[model samples]
Target: MGSPGRSHRRLPQAPDRKTSIQEAALLPISRRQALALGGAALLAGSAGDARAASPQGQLTWAVHVSLAPTWFDPAETPGMITPFMLLYALHDAMVKPMPGQTAAPCLADAWKMAPDGLSYEFTVRKDVTFHNGEPVTAEDVKFSFERYRGTSASVMKERVAAVETPDARTVRFVLKKPWPDFLTFYSSATGAGWIVPKKYIQQVGEEGFKKAPIGAGPYKFVSFTPGVELVFEAFEGYWRKLPSVKRLVLKVIPEESTRLAALKRGEVDIAYSIRGELAEELQRTPGFTLKPVVIQGTFWLYFPEQWDPKSPWHDLRVREAAALAMDYKSINEALTLGYSRVANSIIPDSFEFFWKPPPAVYDPRQAKALLAAAGFRNGFDAGDYYCDASYANLAEAVLNNLQEVGIRVKLRPLERAAFFSAYAEKKLKNIIQAASGAFGNAATRLDAFVMKGGTYAYGHYDDLEALFAEQAVELDQKKRTELLHKIQRLVHERVIYAPIWQLAFINGQGKRVRESALGLIEGHAYSAPYEDVTINTG
Candidate 1:
């Protein structure tokens, strides 16, 4: 598969498979296509193989962002991958993207889609048990799916006709129509398929369950202090294998300086999102390793006010000015030391049916001319620009460029959680620097960020919406690709978003950490497959 950052290159697709849902006939475990669909898990060793060391010591992490309680609950996952950082540690999904495969079988050892594509079946693993000693049955899978109230929950529920549990191990989902993205959406793209204890949730209630969550993952929840830290202990009964480390601790360190300070003091084994000079320092320091993980998150400047006829952004020239004003190359070099790939489209090149737009031309004179033509000869106040506080530097950089082109705006940095909440509710106006790191291809990206009623979309174009609808049910692979490509091209031509770049998340680890698990999973910014992470006991 080609990197999504690579322009004009067609991403490789799995052999003998079509992107259309109507033609997608998935088989059970052991088949090549089934294996392809179920991305291969990042297993440390074969379950039967003897390990050299028993689980020991504690592995602590200094995370770059605040740990939101919403992340602990798979039921409320947004249309992003942030929650999965915690979910991978505390819970197990039916099928999930692991190191190499996009939809690896986890709890459900095998899954198959019916020939007609109206139904899908999953064969639950018989050996798995929740942290509470209760068996993970097919009922749990059905319960979890039905209870999901996450980002894409409504669309999923509307399409699914019924969920059936024929036995303790077999769970079937009958859809109202043939949805080609069933596996992609349910398994990897959304948390709809991440299983939870059926009886436990009912017994404890939603609030209580969140207070003390339990799952069939490698780690069992020990404690959680809001805005501080989350602690977990190894779950011996975890079906995959015993975790390498006995204890895991995730500490929230919102400040980059403080995170690096913690890492320098050996207070944390791993630190995430270290960038710029701090990254250079980490690379220079002995006994420390700095890694740059190229993630799928492509940042972009969104003009929510563009849809409003009364706003200056309603004029195409003004939008184009904003796009042309950005100095992408300099921004990349300054922030990531040129590690981040300058993005040309909202859709990453790695995605299926991706359409690469022409390279972004940064011409301040052209931008000024466009703004002047839009009747803003002396510049205009563009209201508040909302962004995650963690990336305030990025927002400032973008603001500086826009200001140079007469599009003045004030920076409004919110905490990561609040920023997302505000964006989703459409409370913030003007420019929004947004990014989506969720799994899936071009179609999923379009559905979430471009289509009408998308979780993050404030408005939609009628023609684009129609094209999206037309492609949703199109069974022909070539036709689907063409339709998707057209939608992307239209978005680019209209200057809906000023595409930034695919992020190169610079992270670091100490000598005590044997396997940080960083960069092991492609497109995942954080260290993952918690059970595979190990620390030196000696």
Candidate 2:
């Protein structure tokens, strides 16, 4: 608690059932452990009507980097929910996307898109209260959207053409055109067109507002240490029951191995999804467990359009050869301990209608033949860029795979911050990069690679501008799928991203880590996880 001022946010709390944690460990008991523990007493027992009678009730979560959201003003970045991630514990989004459930209400009890197709209305839930104890007003709900559009979020402005509040407790959005995918955008992490407190923003300008903001969620932020840590306390009056625990900490530790080691040593209680090569070992450790949950993310490579003219990769044959040469099987087994899957397509299994029904294509010898036929029989040496603390190792595994085909690889690693900034500019000199955590949407995939100015485009697909213009505006799911499927099929055929496995957004934590999922998995838009899970203390 004495680690200096941490950011403030509200978290939800719930009373623990006496046998919840035990019941959760549903595995049949063993004789040796049962006999030895038959006489041993339970460590902490009993729960009250209000809270856990004995709850360390505090949780510490670790991730590879601090929550450095690029844009807090959601309007600035199209579909970005930086504020939501920042205010996750402190506020809730209107609809939450759970593992199996369709989008359900968080702040607003229910919502409907008008028959006209351009207007969307919501019946704001009147039961919620802000951390400040004020009744959540309909005005507040309307204000969150208007406030997000403070001329700062140009991207948001472009996507959300207009907003109108026709009545108290009702907010309607009238778009320039009918968008059936409206729900998809709102549910997206970046699509959280949240209603920020208009009064608070007026009181504290932009910079001041980011330092501390308000939301109606399960936890309240207390303070933040840039690049170090964030501490949160439970919001008892959360619309949902308060979180079972009293406090939570989101600690940033960038070193992948060190983070895993920290979890093993009990230095931190929880680590978010950790997808490095060390996952299997961590799962095997006693009293600690690994839970592999499906994530809406995919990891792959990038090419700088700026440098494409100078490389042989521009030739489709060479590019395909390179893609074929990268031994995903060996890479997954050696670097990821065979815990990961080789991604043949950019669309991951979690995405709707994603058919993972067939065998993966892998042919290093064929890749060699293709490379030899491409006029450079000797193959070529290249450098790949990696920013993750542990990604260099994955890069090395890739290097080995490529090396077998007479292609030499040099691993280039940059600091996470530098790597990200460089990537944003699309100025990488070489071909090695890893991209993941794309919230599952056809548009998300299209935006990443096919958009005129996309993050993954880096310069590989030059003619994609036309495709993106149409894909971006096509609102019909079936029509959009045809386009998305064609574009992604092109992604594989073109081998623009000599794809690495689609990695889950993973982190590592210790003995007390419980939840397999976290609030941040959805990207920068939504904030509804603090009260979702019930954790009993270690």
Question: Could you give candidate 1's per-residue lDDT for residues 385-493 as a string of tens digits?
Answer: 9998888988999999999999999999999988888888888788999888887778888888888888888889999999988887776778888999999999999
| lDDT accuracy of residue 232 in candidate 1 | 95
Estimate, for each residue in 1-538, the C-alpha lDDT of model 2 and write its tens digit.
0000112111112313333234323322222112212211111111112453332367777755556533333433332222344445655666544322334345655455555566666766665677777766667766666555322233334566766767766676777776544555564434354545566667887787667756577777687777888777887776655476678777888666677787887777776556555677786678876655334445666555434566777677777776777767766666455656665655666565353423455688998898888777888876564544446666666667778887676777775555655666666666756654534355555565545555545554555556655665675546666766666666566666666675534444455545534543433112236664446445
**How badly does each model clash, as a count of residue pairs?**
7, 53
Per-residue lDDT value at 2 in model 2: 5
lDDT of 1: 0.82
Query: Among these predicted structures, which one has the highest TM-score?
Result: 1
- Tell me the deviation in Å of residue 31 in model 2: 46
Per-model TM-score versus the true fold: 0.92, 0.77
Q: Candidate 2 clash total?
A: 53
